[model samples]
Structures are given as C-alpha cells and as structure tokens.
Target chain A: MRLRIIKAYFLKEMIELIRTKMIMMPYLMPLLIVILFGYGIKMQVTGVRTLILDNDNSQISRKMILKFEHSKYFTTTVKNMSEKDALREIKKANIDAIIIIPSSFEKNSLKGIKTEIGVFIDASFPSRSTTISNYIQGVVMDLANDFNINSSGMININTRNLFNQALRDEEMIVPGLIGMVLLISPAILTALIIAKEKEEGTIFNFYSSPVSKGEFLVAKLSAIFFLVSIAIFVIFLVASYLFDLPFRGSFFLFWLASEFYVFTALGFGLLVSIIASSQIVAIIVTLMLTIIPAFMYSGMIMPISSMSGDAFITAHIYPVMYYNHIIYDTFLIGQGFNSPTNISYLLLLFGYGIVLFLLGLLFLKKEIK
Target chain B: MKIFITILLKELISFFRSFGLVILVIYFFTAEVYVAANGMEIEAKNVAVGVVDKSAGGMSKKILSNLHSPEFQTPKFYKSQKELSDAIYNKNIMVGMIFDEQFEKDYYKKLNPTINILIDSTTASQSLMAIGYIQNILMKFNNLELPVALKMHKLFNQNADTGLFMGVSELLSVITLLTTILTAIAFVKEKESGTWDIMLLMPVNPKIIILAKSLSQIIIIMIGVVLSVGLILFQSLDVPINGNLLHFFILTFFYVATTAGIGLFIAAVSKNIMQISQLSIVIMMPIIFLSGAWTPIYAMHPLLQYLSALSPLSYYIEGCESIFFRGTSFVDLLPYFGGVLILGVILYWYGFRKIGKLF
Candidate 1:
C-alpha cells in the first residue's frame, strides 16, 4: 500500500485505457443515455389519437364533442362513422380510444334524464389507459358543469405540486437517469477492463510483482473512478443546462454523495471482474446485474414505497435506490444535509461503497486459481 | 448444404460448451422475467399520505377516512401544515392534505370549500395516479348530480393489471437484447481468440458460414423465449394468449432475425467483446426507446413518432400486443409482418455484405 506503487499502477492503468481507446465509453455512454431517455421517455401520455362518433348530431352533442377536442390529453376527430367502425379502428391499433355519443343524447339531457356517453378505451397498457379514462371523466365533468347540471358536492381540491412546479417529466426522469448512467457506465467499464487483463494474461504481472492486493485494487478503482467522475460532471453540467434543471441543494453535498455512489459502482465492477472467466462473460454479467435493477427497482420509473413483497426488499438491497433518493432530494426537494433522512441515505451509500470494495479485495487472489 | 449443416452443428456445440453463458441465458429467460413482472407496479399502490385536518369530527373526518389501504396508506395525522410540509420534504410522505377550520362550515353553507393538496411530484406516475384516486374519492362529497353520465369501457385488459403487461414487455425486451448479443458475440469471439484467419481459410461459402452461425444463435434464443413464455408469462404471471400461438412465434422469429441483422453489423465493426457491449447499448437503447415497450409510441413527439417506423421493434411490440390482447387475426397482421420484413431484409443485406467482405 505504498504511495509510489499506487501512483505507478494508477498511471499505467490510465495510459492503457487511453491506448485502447476505451476511455471514450464513459463520456459517450452518458451523453447517449441522456439524449435518448431525456427526450424519448415520457410518462405523461398526451396527444391520445381518438375518434368520436356523434350519433346525436345535435348542438349539445357537438358542444360535448368540442370539450374532448379541447383537452390536451386527447386529440379527437369527429367522423360520421358508426360505433362498429370506431371499434374496428381501435382493433387495428390505429387509435387510442373511441368516444360514442348516443343518438338520443340531447333529448335526454334537456329533460333531466341521465344520458350515458360510451367511452371505449384501448387498455392494453393499463397505466396509460387509466390516465386517459381519468382525462375523459374530467372532460365530461367539465361538460356537466357547463350544462349547469349540479349533481355532486361542492368540494374543490386545489392540488399544488410541491417539488417540481410544472410537473415536467424530465425533472423527475433526468435525476433518475443520472443515477442510472452512473451505475451502468462505471461498473461496466471497470469490470470489462479488469476482465480484459485476466483474458489477455496481463493480470499475472500484478500477481508476480511486489504490489499488494489492496494497493493494486485501489489504484485500478481510483483511476477508473477519476475518469467516471469527470464524465458524470460533464453530464451534470449538460443535463442542468439542457433540461434547465435547478440545483436546489448544496453542490458539495451532491458531489460527495455521487463520489460514494461511483465507488460502489466501480467496486461492483471489480467483484464481477474477479469472478468472470472472460471479457464477454464479464460484460454480459455486468449488464444483467446493473441494467435490470437500475430500471426496475431503483424507483426511476416505479416508486419503491408502493412496491410490495420481494420487490420492496430488493429495492432496499441495491445502492442505486439510495443514490436515487439523494438526487431527488437535492435536485427536486432542494434539501441538503439538514434532513436526517438525507444523511442516512448518504451514509448508506458510503457503506455500500466500503462493503463492495472490501468484497472485491477479499475475492482478488494473488495467484491464479 | 453439407458444409452449412456441419458449421451449424459446430456453432451449436460450442455455444453449449460455455456453461456460464448457458446459465446466463436460462436465468434471463426465467428468473429475470419473473422478478420484473411481479415487482414492477405502474399503478398507484400503498401511496404514503399525510393529513392535517383542522375541521375534525365533520366531513373532513369522513373524507380523511376514505383514504384507505391499497390505494393509500391510512393518512398520518399531523399537527399542522408546517409538520406535514416537513414530512414531504423528508420524503416521509408523498402526498399531504390540509383541511382548514372553515371546511365543514363552508361545505354546509354551499360555499365551495377548498382542500389544499400538497403533492411531491418527483415520482410522476405514482403522484399522478394518486391524484386521480383522490379526485374520485372527493367526488363522493360533491353535491351536484350531473344529468349526463360517462360510462368507461376498458377494453382488452379489464382490470388494467400492469403485471400481465410488464411481464410480456420484459420478455420481449429480453428477446431483443439476447438475440443481438449472442449473434454479435458469436462472430466477435472468433476474431478475439485469433481464429478468424482459420475460419476464412475454410472452403465453405462465407454466406453459408454467416447463415449457419446466426441461425444457431437464433435457435438458442427461440429456446430461451419458449422457456420464458412457458415458465414466466403463462405459468406464473398468467399472461393470456388470445390469438393463435403459432402467429406469435412466427412474429418473434421475424423480429429475432431482424435484430440479429443489427448484431451482424455490430460484429463487423467491433474488434473485441468490450466494443460489442458498448456498441450494443448505443444501438439498442434508441431502438428500445422508439419501440414503445417502455413508453407508448403515440405519446412520443411527432418527429420521433415518424422515426419509430424505421425501428423494427415498434412493429414487433405492436404486432405482439395485438395478438395477445386485441386478438387480431392473421390476415389483419399483414401490415406488421410487412414492416418487419422490409426493414429486416435491408438491415440483413447490409450486415451480410459488411461481414462478407472480410471473408
């Protein structure tokens, strides 16, 4: 664990990485992920292509149809088609939903008789369908209010979205995407680099030399960690400027937590490299471990609190969830070290880093098996 | 023909020889699908909510009581707005409610009472769904009886269970990823291990060799898909197959072939396994994003929506969902088939030519 040995190994690792042209991966991967997901993945389903069959053709039905057209959630086209044709359009996967206003709608509404407007939705994806259904109901409710049909109570709920004022999907997605990119790139880069040494028999140099295991592992981890940190910093700057993401919390605190997270990722990569027999196996194993959990359990798309049973436990096990919490709190909630919960998550991330690195050192054999 | 058979057999035997890869494939097809399907919940469930009801023992209590389990946790009673806001900031609660002292009086006097809802919208999907649920609950307290009622018929999936959808979607994504990686690695492995010259020196046609290698990996992937569909989708998750099973498999074969074409291109460019993985993610992420597996195509921007037509995956996902959920007929499935085939031929030809030049 001498300083000279560590520095020499670190420089060697850096030069080798640059020589192989693998250094570009950390920078390129985050840029690609940010561009792809930031612009591409949207939770808010808008511009729902809809077809309307106004069988009534009355002024009241026309006004009702106009409400659907005005709502941002739905883009409706009033066509002179039967219900059968509208449904056929839905089956072709051409349209998202169909609104059928019956032939006798105006007559019944004027007489205070309850009129039923049929809303057939394509519920293949339940979450999207539910949002569409809610939107339709909201439009219908507005129409009811317009008609002065006072059917329900007078309670008005004013929802104030707290953290993200506009409720922009990018505000939530970008922070989580940062966590995901950090996890995947560092882990994969370290794992593959180390596994490449093993595959090419370059690892025997370390085994045959006077370098200790702790010093060897630390030098490799730190060198890759330095590269990953710069890449993530560039990503942070680009994402903040591009998405107009507000940094509500302390930059130093966020930087510190991110470093811990990067260490955890690199250590996991080290563990994978130790166990993998070849470069191909190492890459696949790293992907299988990182990509799935990052998407599923990290609370990026799904909320951990709402998850039940094994999923909840699994989310707790991954360090990505902890980092996700820190990113959301600092970026969205604008909270820093003041909150006890935030501190605990930061500490947990630190603990994950130490544990993973220790595990890597424990597994790294001085001699070939 | 004899040469193609021999090469195909050689590829299959070598694939089986790699014990780690075999186990990786099996785990991906089985355990991976099961965990993702059972765990991922898109709909709101057990949302943590906090409440400060100043107008106690009146309609406020009744409204507060309506927030129950499954949709929400029993609302934690906080002392004031300050405490509740702190709870939200601490990430202790997702949604907070404040009912002022005038709530009950305002309701009785027909003076539209407003209940302030403080929501942490960082988790967009959950918060949005929770808002819808709260609105539905509050509708019970509304007095006006509208003359017109809207009846919603949720077609295909009646209950709107996300498990069924996620399970199948996960399976489809897994199929895409594995097909591309396996095919790319098959060729890249030869180059990495210094066997490329020997492979080129063989008397067999390069086309036959390429066809045989890719076909072997595709067969392996088909087996993985069958295992996933049987063990995870059908047996555990109960994803209903509404249309003919043969139609789904045929569609899957076309998709696998198209993706393998992309893999061929990746192998032609990369010198080793590291580049294969990196390049795979670079190429695959955009395809997956455009495919509407994670996000629906209709939800994308107009420019991206048009671009999705170039991605073969978009058609595959739509075609599969139609067969499984919409029960679309084979004749009606022609457009999807056409989309995949047209794209597959172009991509396959390009990749085939790129690698064939090396031989």
Candidate 2:
C-alpha cells in the first residue's frame, strides 16, 4: 500500500518489459488483428463460382444466364457442358454451384408453361451454400418479375437495415476485433511477465523484500494497464481512420468502459500467472481461457441470441461478451450510457475487474510455497 | 539415430510429466471441440421479432402467424412503431414490423400495401437470413403464380447442418494453434531453463536435435487431432468421413509439419515463451483468416483471394472438406497435397537452418 514501494515495483516491471521489447506488442498486435480481420473476415458471401449449362441455346435462356452473371452474388461461366460434367466440377471442388437450363426451358417459359431451372449447389460448407441458394432465389425472382410473372402479391414488404445500411461485415468485425485483440494480448503479456518472475526465481526479490503482496500485484497490473490503455487509444484511431469506423456514441463513456475492461483482462492474466508454474504453462492457460470463449461465445462469429442452453449461459458468464455489447452499441447503434442496459453492462465489467483482482490477490503468495 | 531417439523419448517424457498441460490438451481436444460444434448456430434460429399491428386485420394477423418457432420466436405485439424501434435498439428484438391501418383495406382493394420491416444488422448473418425468411412469408401472402420454379439440390450436406462443418473447422484451427505453440515452446523452454548450452554440448547433430524435438510435439498434436476427430467429430457430432480416413490424416500430417516449421522460426527469433505466444498470434491469425475457415474464400476481396494461395491452411482446409464432404479422389487431391508439401519443405528448411546456425 506504500506509494514508494508501488513505484519501485512499477518501474522495475516497465524496465523489464522494455528490455524484452514487449512494449511493441500492444501496438503491433492490434494493428495486425485489425488489418487481418478487417480486410480478411467477411461474412457476406459473394463471387460464388457458378457454371451454367444452357441447353436451350435461346435468347431467353441466355438472358437468364446473364442475370446470374450480373448479380454480385455469383460469377457465372456459360459453357457447353453436360450435367454429368458439371456435377464432376462441383465434386472436384472446382466450382461452388451449377445452373442447368434445360433444352425445353425457353419453349416452356414462352408458352407460360411452368418449367424448372435446376441448381446443383456444393453444400460442403453449409452456411455458404445457404447463402448461395438465397442469392439464386433472389436472381430467379428478379427474372420472374422481368418476365411479368406477377410474383409480387397485393402486399409488399419494405425492408430497411437500420444500423449498418450496406451490411458491411467490417462494421461488425472491426469493433469486435478491438475487444478481442485487447483481451488476448494484454492478458498473455501480463501472465507471461509474472510467470517469468516465478520461473527465473526473481520472485524471491519480492518475497524477501518489504513489498506487500497487494502492492506488488497492483504495481504489475498498473504497468500493463497503463501501456495497454495507450494501445487501446491507438487501436481506436486505427479503427476510425484506417477502417473508417464511425464513432457515434459518447467518447468519454466508451473510454471509461475500455479502462474497466482492460483492468479485468489484466486481472485475469494475474490469476493465470499465479496458477501456472512456468511461463509456457501461463501462456497456454491464458489462451485456453480467453481465445476460444472470446471467438465463439462473445458474439464475435455467432450472435449471442442465436445460442441456446449451455452456450447462452457461458456467454453471460464471460466478461468479453459484455464488452462486446458495449463495443457494438457504441460503434454501431450509437447508444451510450443513456441506456440503462448499457449502464448495467458497464457496471458488470467493473464488477468483473474487481472480482478478478481480488481473486488474483487472494491466490498470490507473499512467501513462495 | 540413437541420439535422436534418446532426445525424442526425453522430450515425450517431459511433455507427459506436465500434468497441467496434459489436462489442457485433453480439454481442448474434447470439451472445446464439443462446445464449438454444438454451440455455434450459423443459420438463423430463434430470431426475436416484434410487430405493431395497427391494422389488426386478417392479412396482417396471417403474416404474424406465419412467423413461427425454430426459425423465429412468435411475434410479440407492440402498441406503436416507436416501442418496436426501442425494442430493436435495446436488442430485445432483432426484427420489428409496423403495419399501417390501411394495410388490410389496401390489400383487399388490390392496392399494394407495404409493411415496414426494420432490421438490426449488427449480426449480419442472422439478420440477412431473417430478412430472407420474412420476404418468403410475404411472398407467400402475395400468392403470385410464377412462370418458372427454381429447384435447388444442396449436394454434399443435404441438411445444411452447421455443426458438422464447424466441428471439423474448429479441429483444424486447433491443430494449427497447438502445433505452432507446442513446437515453439519445446525449443524456447530449453533456452529458458538454461539447458540450451547443455543441449548444444551434447554429442549429437543440432539438426537431429531440432528434428526430434519438433517432431515429438507434432506427434502429440496428431494424437490430439485423432481424439477430436474420433470422440467429438464422429461420435458426438456425427461428422461423416466420405473419403478415406487415411487421406484426411495424411493431409493433416503435412499441415502439422508446415505449421511446425513456422513454430521453429518463431523459436529461432523469440528469446522467451512470451515472445513465442505473441509471435504465434501475429503469425497464426493471418493464416487462419486467409484460409477461409471462418469466412468463405469466394466472399473475400480479390487480392485476399490471391493471397490465400500462400497460406498452407487454405489448402489443408479445402483438402479436408473435399475428403470429408465431397469424397474427392486422390487424383483430384494432388493440388492440395502439392500446396502443403511445397510450402512445408521451404518453411521447414528455412527454420531448420536458422536454428541450426545458432547451434
């Protein structure tokens, strides 16, 4: 609790981090995550490779094929291939789907006799296939409308996307990536630094010194918390400038929430360091706890509402999910601390920080066992 | 040869002795795989919807009735559009609909009555799919007879089960992560424990030592893969093996070796276990991202599509999928094998020399 003792420990931790060149990690990790996930992780399926077998060889069939070609969802190549060959192409993983316009397709369409356009989709990846089928359905509907098929009823549905108008995947992914990167890098760094002290027997310096366990732990956490807070700011700028992420909510509110979340993450690292006997074990344990949950249950790849049973409960228990909500709400929904629900989420983050810090302190021994 | 076996056995023994790491490996291969496969729902399920039925008419009620369980939760009726909008903002409901008073009357008069559907698009996949579902319901209400019917045959995965795909994909990602970290730590641990000098002084080729250590970790990871595939993918999730299981294992072997090369390079440069974890995340994440494990390759930007070719995981994932789902023949599997081998040899050689010189 002494200020002088805390300062000495903090300065020592900082010097060690600088000597190991670990200072670059806070900046480097976020940039890497943003660039890789921002540009790389796309949920919207586009450019599905499609092969068309147009047996009708008529203008109507050609026009139908053109519709598929023009649509952003598909890249169509028309060829004189048989059904068997097209199936072979799909099986070889060469193409994603096949469109077959039979020889009688044009004849039947012109006569108002209902015909069928056969679609063979490679459903190896089920989600992609579902999206492909939806796109194909849309294209077919557009074609039907053009032919004056009157598919539209007396009732029309006008759909509007509220938060992300264009439904850009990055809008969802970048903000979530910020939460993910911040959690993993700081946690791993803090865990490894403490575990290294134990492994190298340097922890005896604190064990034999006048520094209380609380002061030592707090000083270590503060050093990482300080550096990572700066890193978070840099990441926010990167997100806003490089990714063009709009910040619609209160900046002050978001900043306060971030500090709490960072503290919780660092405390989790502290707990892992105390439990692990070696630096390698600490890294592995930290990753095992943080990475999978953050990716799977934090609503990063899958929506939390879509989860059921144990998964839903798991999502609620993790601090990452709460932080994920804050990120999305602030970045996309523009809802800040005004919403009572958002305030609750912020408070939960603070609670998790306090709980994790107490847990780490409780486990940290002043004398080596 | 004797030196290699001795070091290999020593490495394996030490690995087994670490009870904490052993338990973690088991948990990752078993419980982690199980939760991911069973938990993640890619297709839209239980989409919470709210509606303001001002019309209170037959057609509006009929449309509301169409929104049913599994795909959607039964629609909750709200008094006004503002209330529904608030519900959406609060994320209480993903989709909200407001039916004007003229809705049913206009429909009867053959005047197209528009229903305003507001969607929260933060969870893009769910919202997009939900939109499609709503449109279908409205289209059915339109009841317009079309000229042509589009018949879709979903091949490979007839039921569109997300679990089967997710389980296998998670297994692959776990493989990449473990192989890289395990191999890197094997080398870095020796340095951290002040045993690197002793390892160098031993009467053995540095090449044999590095090969033995890295291979030991890969062997451990391969066993973890087997457990995941057997217990989680096959037994629990019922993921089918359409092609020869041997082919899947072979492709995995090449992949593990390739990633182990990256781990060796990481160990060569990193001074501690912390650097190993940091460098692994920096290096491994991009490979996973570009591999199209989470995202479909076709959906990525053209430049990224081109860049995916350089990632060894892209080939491994494609090969495994083709083997499992498509039952592709060995002849057609050559390109995947070639990609893995070519990449593996270059990486393994570079890392082998990098660490060998230090010796």
Model 2: how far residue A187 lies from native, Å: 2.4
lDDT (Cα, tens digit) per residue for candidate 1, span A1-369: 799999998999899989998899889988888878888767788889989988899998888878878888888898997777778788889999998888899999888888898989998888889889988888888877786655333888899998888889889889989999899889988998888888898889988999999998889889989998898789889779998898898788789889999999998899999898788788878888898788878887877766667878988999999998888887888779888888999999999999999989898899979
Give me the candidate number with maximum TM-score: 1
TM-score of each: 0.97, 0.96
RMSD of 2: 2.0
Interface RMSD of 2: 1.8
lDDT of each: 0.87, 0.87
Each candidate: fraction of true contacts kept? 0.86, 0.82
lDDT of 1 at A194: 85
Q: Sum up the clashes in candidate 1.
A: 12
Enumerate clash totals for all models, in the order shown. Answer: 12, 1
Q: Chain A TM-score of each model, in the order shown? A: 0.97, 0.97
List of clashing residue pairs for candidate 2: A153-B142
* Model 2: residues with Cα > 4 Å off, grouped in runs: A151-153, B296-303
